[model samples]
Target chain A: MTSRLTVVYGVRASASEIKARAQAIAVEQSVEMPLSAIHDGSILSDIVGQVRAIDDRGNGAFDVTIDLAAATIGSDAGQLINMLFGNTSLHDDVVLSSAILPSEMLSAFGGPSHGLSGLRERVGAKGRAMTCSALKPQGLGAEDLGKLAFELTMGGLDFIKDDHGLADQSYSPFVDRVRVCAAAVRKASERTGHPTRYAPSLSGSYTDMERQLGLAREEGLDVALIAPMLAGPSNFSALRRNHPDFAFLAHPTMTGARVSPVLFAQLFRLFGADASIFPNYGGRFGYSLLTCKAIAAGLLGSFGGLAASVPAPAGGMSLDRTPELLDCYGEDVMLLIGGGLLSAPRERLAAEAGRFVRAVADHCYPRLSTP
Target chain B: MTSRLTVVYGVRASASEIKARAQAIAVEQSVEMPLSAIHDGSILSDIVGQVRAIDDRGNGAFDVTIDLAAATIGSDAGQLINMLFGNTSLHDDVVLSSAILPSEMLSAFGGPSHGLSGLRERVGAKGRAMTCSALKPQGLGAEDLGKLAFELTMGGLDFIKDDHGLADQSYSPFVDRVRVCAAAVRKASERTGHPTRYAPSLSGSYTDMERQLGLAREEGLDVALIAPMLAGPSNFSALRRNHPDFAFLAHPTMTGARVSPVLFAQLFRLFGADASIFPNYGGRFGYSLLTCKAIAAGLLGSFGGLAASVPAPAGGMSLDRTPELLDCYGEDVMLLIGGGLLSAPRERLAAEAGRFVRAVADHCYPRLSTP
Candidate 1:
């Protein structure tokens, strides 16, 4: 029997038309043609997707579960996504909600080489949630961005990442930016006695990213921020495999509207993201509190003996809400406040950063409370 | 002065909130921080996204145009997408409608190494719409698929492509499938006295794809199919740059719901798709006739001295509708009939495919049609 993985999709259709829709999705996602056209008995029995279950959610929505052959994927990450949601994504009425991967598929993916615990060890955070910020407002020169990185490091933040916008632009070439920021973080760490990590955003082709990674490694940087959606899931997987020592923070860019956030977090972690960053509830974006909790749970939940990934909630997050965010997310999280910390006066930026770090540290978790 | 590109987004908001929402999108996409925090003179003057126009489309909908600095893109296809819709994609209320790319930005991308004319020359097709079909129902072995390819070639189709689902699966590995299919097409072409290009689907990491291309070249196959969205835009661009002799058929998978299909066609062509395949109107997907026309126009229209890409309309297309489709798309298109021919009995499959070819060949395009 072929190894199978289960995938669930939230489909919008009337009750009467749901069975055909679910079956159509199963065929559309797998054989992609009439089942009678398939001549091979093994192919018919094993390869064609089987609709496992369909539960109506009312208001023109239903949850559909499908079982697909693992042989069709063959340890290829890109093909896995292609099999999971490639052609089906074309149907506007369907949303890929979740999946239950077989053990072999999970083993093939090899989630998080350096996950939450590894990240904590790198930053030396014992029992408190991590504090993080971003270097933003694109077109800044390397020296200027380095100065900002220095202040954030001085304020004892665990991670200072490059804004996803920062790439190999002429104004602040990737090499120059990494060199200066690495040195600045190292210099500040020597004084503050905190091992704050600086994660530069990666861009360009897979080869370009490899070259960038070489430069980052030369600068003694281990953590790197990458948008898996922008880089392609296969490239991200390849990078992770090639650089086992490097911890990755997956940026939720170009992906938010494509798939469910919970599924994305799970996939990112499985693809080797030590931390997955996303827009928090009541932020600039539209993810609700319930969705945020699910994303966090998906990342931190147990799955196929893989390490847990740190969920970094961000996007227009403020220092004032740090306690509430921590209370909701618990301790295995990274509170990323970007514009909120940057909004402080230039002279008082480090103080504001310190306050963010302190806010997370001072927050007490409510006993037996569900986020 | 910084070179700028204009990106238009369709926003879902009230008339009263359109201005603020548009401005917020500008700031969020460019800086990802509050404008007050950016004190750099050049950054404020040049790097910040400027709202150029906003037109109300009624019923809480508006078209908003924002000009972003071209320098931020930095000659990187992935970063170009990141700058265009990365963070904004997180906002459910927004949809990327189109972009007016700067010439330099256009030059950097360098659309389609071997576009429509080049592809037409390869198959010796002239003065008529090209005929194409996909080898589908993915679980067949290499030899079985090869036999199908031979039959399709015997039918005198212009192009035969691998189904997007036919990846490097264990059931039919890419190398074996490509080798067999290539040989089969060659054999059938010798007998039929017509050139039928075989386009194997490309998948896996960049390095893996490069190796696959090498294998394809060895088998004397000049055309290959790829999903730019699945491969990552930068990797696709790099592949085009690295292999100037090859023709690419861009598959619209994992991309349909994210951006406007018209914009997707333009972007795919810009990233080097000789033929951009999309769901035709009245097909399995939900694209309307107007949207399909716009997609075709975007692919065929003059843009920055780039070669025109053939818009291949596919998905649940049939032989009977060939004349109607020909009238809708004209001679500058590739009419793809997949399952329509495959549904025929094994004995009549070639005859059905021949009928499909004849349908396109016999149909006369309407005079001065818009599509």
Candidate 2:
């Protein structure tokens, strides 16, 4: 009656060798001893991960599926992650292409509180994809960054977040920056009567984090940004569990190197990110279009009956690429453009944002009038 | 007066092309825009990262140092990490070799609270190098694990942590395991008059984590294990900050791919681990000897005036390699033996632990009596 996790391992060995390796994995990943060492009455007998099926995927590469006992990982994200690929990550041949955790285990780590639809509802946008951008070049004082946020939000972007680089540095201390930027976004909403969600980067000590989160709430900010890779998945999950009102936008920064894009996106959604941000393909990052599509699919599709999270495609996005991106990801995606907007002349910044919004509008609502 | 980060990037282009790529990195990782677009009063004008030096290392590799305004990252570890190699990590050719954060920034992250001397004092050993082992083979009931802990402690190991596989599974829940393991170590210490610290894996909800730490303390445990890659560096740092008494042992899991062994070890130490644990070369994992040596050096070396953290190398460690492990790591090492000890016949388990401990002691205190 135990639930299992099916993991597809890319192993390099002969058919016979694969069997040996699978047997080794069964021990290595769990008991770390031969079957004889495990006692008769030990619970280890029941909970040991088993290599169920091995399918060859050409040239010494076999898609080894290991069924790990759900009880082994239990409810801990950290332990589950360790079981998934901790020791195996160091091995070159064992690439973890996919992992399907049992529902009982997945539910323990609560998924997004406010998912794609909830986020779209918060943005109050209809018939068009959401546009997200960053206020960047981190050395700015809180006042200056706040001003930029005001301009961008007023210019028609649905979501305005701090750049992944924005942290609690002296130039813009987190408390000060979040306070000012939150205020600025509110002011923009007041003027344009169009609310734009501000997601400040979450970083610093737990006490400091609590204060920052509280401050964002006090300032009426709806969304918060956290680079889950840097902060850890558990921390993010804890935040999502505690704060039901704030939508989380998970940033993929300083972490794309280790995690496969699709897996990262899937975990991001599973860990309660309303918007899972990633470096889009055909952009500055070398992610393939297929990987981006896969990531998008993972975020939007249902797994473990969790709510669908938004797929935020970022990095080198320009107004010109909006239609192609729309064609690629369809309607339920967030187009995050940073450098491209900063490339515009300051006098034309608002106009540039407006153009990007119009560009998205045209693609999504082709027959309808631009609103 | 701004501090800079020195990064060596592995490029796939000519010398001039490397220079250009370095230039691109400066803007891409910081402003994410061309300098021409930045205006007089913009933050990009003042705080944009500068490519200070680019040394051609031949073979399309170059050591490029980018002098970024310290204010760009601020003091948050998450932000500093993001700024250091976030966007660049997505680049296939870009490999980060070393990073020197400003002293102010480094101190803010807070390196190991309980370092080499502190750990040595905690285990009640003045001169001899410490011994550490694991209580693993995950399926064991709390009773067996507790008994095993008692034997290993009596056999003369300083530290005993859980196998990365050991989690809050149904067979052995975390709370129950910690209680049994802690009591066993305490009983062993009572008889042997030697302290053997038990560090259960910290890998669940913050509440569950808090309870585990509390229970460990309640039962007189001194050390706790955390895999920072899975739990997040910030969580580990916060734990170190909050619990000054407990020694933190970091497990390198699910993270070796993104970070170089040396840099990863350095960062682990920087984030407040009393000991940095990683897979050694010639073990089950594929880390090279040179890389393992570098990791050991990183843990032991003085960086930002932080105390030295012990280098605990494990994964397929055995009694035979103890002398070589000691030779490679010198005295400031914790050789983690897992299955090696587990494979020993039930009657000879304690004796096997004693031999391994003697091997380490022989290298460190060659002439000293077995006191």
Candidate 3:
């Protein structure tokens, strides 16, 4: 039977010692190993298996994988995998790496409730590149931010997301912000005969989260951005089950502390995010280039059962870096440039973003493909 | 005028560089300072003045404090404190020390609805020390664990708690386990008249948490144990509002990740915990004796017209160490002995627990000044 894998990185200890610690954590968090299992030197024989790997940098980092018992991890295997990482964090220097769990792998979301083709179809972009930007820096009044968002949509950006920091602050209350931004986007779309979608940040208590979702629906907003850790685990499952019509764009905030370099993609995809936005390789955060590529690959990789999620490489994304990111992450991607687009003059932002997106598409898919 | 204090530890860097980084995090997480604040050097000046003290522990550990702007924190000051620590964590070796925000502390949960004297009155332990122990080592079945709890209660322990690891699992399903244990504790209490109360672990989804609380109430359980972080921020407040009659005992499970030598007592005390349980000094957890003492002092310290909370010291506690812990924490504390009690023979566990409790009482109120 194929089992879920968990890769942990830690200081270089004796192989036996590392194995013992790993087994202890697995038993402590999942199934407890009996005395006989230990005596037989198969303490984790039923629940997990051992793998060999080491960190070359030598800053006390080693990589080891454990095979998860199907019983230990129930139907919600994604959450089980996350719990493995979370529980192991009780120890020192154990960062989560990659995970291979059972789930649908083709559709954009776990099973792409809407894949790239579907999303592009909805946006009326068959084979062309799409430019996205964020309504940023937070603390701005709803009216001010909404106006900026309208200008950007009119200017030609395909997507406009509220900055990850823009939660339910009073300065820009979620309801008012979503209403204003949605109206602006719609107005721009009507004026330009071009469509633009808005994804507002959803980070609040369960009740407040519901209010935000309801407000987005009322205002006819295209997508709702969410950060699971910030919102809480049940919120996502509840939103998916109850509010099936609401499109979700998941942001990585307060989440990196758990998954780190390894199991991020699998967890995010399984969490049921349509498009998972993560910090890029050369960004303000800590994810490495190889790890970033792995995230994209894992998201697009073959999953026997799990749904696929679109990898949105964000953070410190600039026009100059578009080609590099696109080359690394294939055509099935979303280039989220937030602050960089905002800093430029309003007139230049849309054209600059559009040019960068075209360049990325051309470079990644040399032959003339779709839009 | 009391400012929030945050302690950050980092490798030796110029004061200017550290100042810049600290200021940046403050602005990023908190209220954004105006250019005037940055230009007049008021932002940096404020940080400098707010820093009550700085202690550099040569071995890459440093403690520094900052007076936070109240406006930056918003209505939820505790969240602001968490944000302060969360932001600083991106930088290496930075630990949050103590946070002393504006007084309005207990206004949140109205302090401990029932404190030491109240509990004593309710349990009718006017002259005796309260005995307590946790059901532990995890791995055991629910029925078996319930049987042990019965023995401990019959042995005259005042309180029985589930080990922090005891969550909703298949082996010991939460509701069934709670029903059996609560019933057992009741039977034991009836036979002994010691009024042993059971507090089961309440850590999970919001809906499930409500179900757990409801089950506890239906089963005639006295208190509900919670780990706030694992549950979420709004959990305590919601619990208090929904089940005003129930007593909430917050546990420290996913919290050590935040407060190990970083933030100090002031912040945790006011953040909605009526009886905050932390790892004792010289325990397996590595917190210093001084830090433990500080936690106690902070919890019991008066905060802005709010009543004090009982500090419960736990983890790696033993019967032998009871006298020392009692002497250090005094009578107002709740002594939590877990594995030590579990390891003892069933026949002697209660008396051993009672002996430890009596010793604490003898150390604290010796004779009650019968004049």
- Which of the numbered candidates is closest to the native, going by highest lDDT? 1
Error of 1 at B13 (Å): 1.8
**Model 2 clash pairs?**
A44-B139, A169-B74, A254-B86
Residue-wise C-alpha lDDT for candidate 3, range A75-176, written one tens digit per residue? 332235334553454344555555555343222223335545555655676555456778865456688778778877876666788876666655677778
What candidate 2 gets wrong by more than 4 Å, as runs, is: A11-26, A33-36, A40-45, A59-61, A364-371, B12-17, B40-46, B53-62, B205-207, B364-371
Worst-scoring 10-residue span by lDDT in model 3 chain A: A32-41
Q: Candidate 1 on B123-143: residue-level lDDT in tens? A: 888888999988977899999
- lDDT per model, in order? 0.91, 0.79, 0.61
TM-scores for all predictions: 0.97, 0.93, 0.83
In model 1, what are the clashing residue pairs, if there are any?
none
Better of 1 and 3 by DockQ: 1
Q: Could you tell which candidate, 2 or 3, scores higher by DockQ?
A: 2
- Residues forming the 10-long window of minimal summed lDDT in candidate 2 chain A: A36-45
lDDT of 1 by residue, A247-289 (tens): 9999989884757889988999988899999889999888999
lDDT of 2 by residue, B256-327 (tens): 465576887788888888898888889877789998998999899879899899998888777898887777
Q: Report the Cα lDDT for residue A332, model 3.
A: 77
